[model samples]
Target: MDKSITVACVQAAPVFMDLEGTIDKTIDLIKEAASRGAELIAFPENWLPGYPWFLWLESPAALTPLVYQNSLVLGSEQAKRIASVAKENNIWLLLGLSERDHGTLYMVQWLISNTGETVGVRRKLKPSHVELTLFGESDGSSLKTFTTELGVIGALCCWEHIQPLTRYVMYAQHEQIHIGSWPSFSLYCDITAALSPEVNIALSGSYAVEGQCFVIAPCAIVSEQIIEQLCTDKIKRNLLKAGGGYARIFGPDGSELTTPLAENEEGLLLATLDPASITFAKAIADPVGHYSRPDVTSLLFNPAANRPLSIKAASFIELIYTKQIVLPGSEEVQAN
Candidate 1:
């Protein structure tokens, strides 16, 4: 007998920078997915409290202390509220956000079980070069999975799915239901032109097919309404009018299994997962199992790549000391 699970790929045209609004939107999507018999629901990245646009919009001058004004923590009170919605709906949830951890930020996706247990978090192993201007480091500690009633669940945020080794880790853990969460559609932004409309699902499908897992991929659509509210700049408005991206899902073989929702409108598409696909696909070539040959060449664990801050603490401290003379209230002098 084959096991089946209904999954939803929700496309939300999030009103940028509005935390309360995004959370409410997510809660509504959760209800809709559940109503459609979805056992697992996935959302686009940075769904809660919204993606801070200062970096993307080049508006960082608005920074302040109390709010950190730059980054907000992932497990913050505001996000916990979204987690509650997942629990209340009684479905496994995979949501993405710019996770704030203390003063540092990481592009992250969290897997929450129906019972509201935050089982595991998969951070973007390597932030895109420009993304480093805002997001923080993702270390080994954040790579893991959570056992859920529906199946073993895991997640990855945006481009991290492009990293072969990163995708290998999830495959190693034997994840059944993989959530591929994307950011709000960023089709024409000068910075994100490379992340195309077709690439979102195409790449996501490659991951599902390659990893032998069902991928519930969700992405945002840049709608006329959200554009009207957030695109005050003429260039930004024109970019949105051009087009955003689509949210979609794939079977274990990486085949498109559902249709995308309307732009700027929020909705979910539900489909069941078949475990046999993984077994059948893996028989072709399991990247980690019968397909791999450690004897040929070993895979390097690049600690520095993922944990730069943890790796450079003393150097960072030295840099801080070098700037101390310019800081206020420090008498021109003493050495420790």
Candidate 2:
């Protein structure tokens, strides 16, 4: 609603495998940012209970129970409490978590309004490489933008920003603010030759340019404390050594709005974004409108939410009375 809004990116690691501890930390950060006039605040991917670096060190079987115990479930008391924090602070909250649903866990993000209501919930469309083994992939429904009082906001986790079609999808939705959530780059640089913090930063900047939207990229840092707490093995500890934090904010014109925090700093990166900038940028090139070639190319998008199968009672009477129906041939057998 304001001409300029102060947005913040929280770059910090979580208390590994400690759900309650991480939630408390998140609340503290949210309150601190809100006190400093941050209207919209976003956290790094898997910020709650931290990223599963164990996937790279330990086998899937070895880490399954640990992850399940730490990840959050939708509508749980913890989730409600987090929403209450947003309402109490009167700030828009965009938080990332390792979500536990039924028997599966997902890399999910929640957009909470000032009223403390969850406006949108999106899961990562596809987890990157080894992440696929730990988190479940989201459907097209998760690829969406929401209309908020501030503006149209959308989000994608880590490498999803580089997915050409995925980027186009957000651009087409006219997202004014895009949340880019990522784990530590230290996890990537050591494992692969090409991916690093520098490469990821460049991608984020370019994404702002291409999408013509302000980007709030919040990257997590692997601290020595975290390493000491989780990585008992020398190899694992070395792999997760400190300093990967790179929380930043980019303008609609693809300019850096704020200097990134030090690789090891645990704090919020805040930037004031002028709503007029989006108008100016779109006037030059609106990808969804003036710059798009709808006739030449078109994308088929589905917005159906996924759900598990359930058997329901045939009628309300059956449900209320606990009545059972018997088949014509099998009179003794009842199906309730």
Candidate 3:
């Protein structure tokens, strides 16, 4: 029997900064995709509450309202609601968002299992260009893949996919399915050079071929309607045009599996992939396996999550001191 599964890449614009509205739309899309037999679904980066396009157009300090209003708090009721949807639908969900971790906000993705359990919360190892001012970078612990009932799944946000070392790290973990999520290219394309949809498509395809894993690259759409409402500056408006939807799926051999939806179209790009295809592709060139030279070069990974604060129980601290001290009168205890 062939080990095959159906997957989906959701391509849509969020209800721009409206958390509840976006979630409702996301749920509806999830249900629709589920009905179409999509076993796993990948949403665009910052799909909920949407990506902060203003960060690129205006000064980071100027867009405080946009960030505060849309940023998601991890483990909040909103997150639980998403988990419930995944569980009820019996589908694996890879959800991307701008997470508010207390005072700091980070670009993060949460992998929810079919049982509604959140298996992994991975953040973007590095934010790009203007993103640095708005979000915090992730630590080594976030650079990880999860082994679930479906397979070893992993994710990277936007341009993180362009980093060679980052891609190698995921490849080293032997991920079977990789989700490459992106904010609308409209924000980056005109403002910057060479960071357009075409460039991203090549990168996603290259990742699938090099890593020998299925790649679901879900890009967001920035409609003219959104630009009209949010962008007040004429220069910013000119830069962020409509039609950014470029969601795609690729096979292990770098073959584009599904036809991408229109750049401005909102829909899911579905594809049925065979796990056996990975085996076939890797047989030719497994970068971490037959193709690697560990003697020549190797990666030193630090798998530690950065925590601002750590607390130790008073009892636990006392137990250590209790072993170190002894009564002065007791010779054996002072000992020897």
Q: Cα lDDT of all candidates, in order? A: 0.71, 0.87, 0.86
**lDDT tens digits by residue: candidate 1, 279-311:** 898899887788978799556654333433564
Candidate 3, residue 205: the lDDT equals 95
**Candidate 2 residue lDDT tens string, 183-263:** 878864667644688888888888888888999999888877777766888778666667788888999899999877789
Candidate 1, 82: how far from true, in Å?
A: 2.7
Per-candidate count of clashing residue pairs (backbone under 3 Å): 6, 0, 0
Q: What tens digits encode model 3's per-residue C-alpha lDDT throughout 1-336?
A: 136899989999888888888989989988988999998999999887788877777778887667777788878999899899999999989988888887888888989888899899998899988889888888999999998878899999998888898889999999999999988777556556667888888999999999999999988899776898768888877778787888999999999999888898899999998988998999999999999999999988888888888996566446445555455665334222
Deviation (Å) of 315 in candidate 2: 12
Q: What's the TM-score of every candidate structure?
A: 0.80, 0.89, 0.92
Which sequence of candidate numbers ranks them by lDDT, best first?
A: 2, 3, 1
List candidate 3 segments past 4 Å from native: 188-191, 312-336
Question: Which candidate number has the best TM-score?
Answer: 3
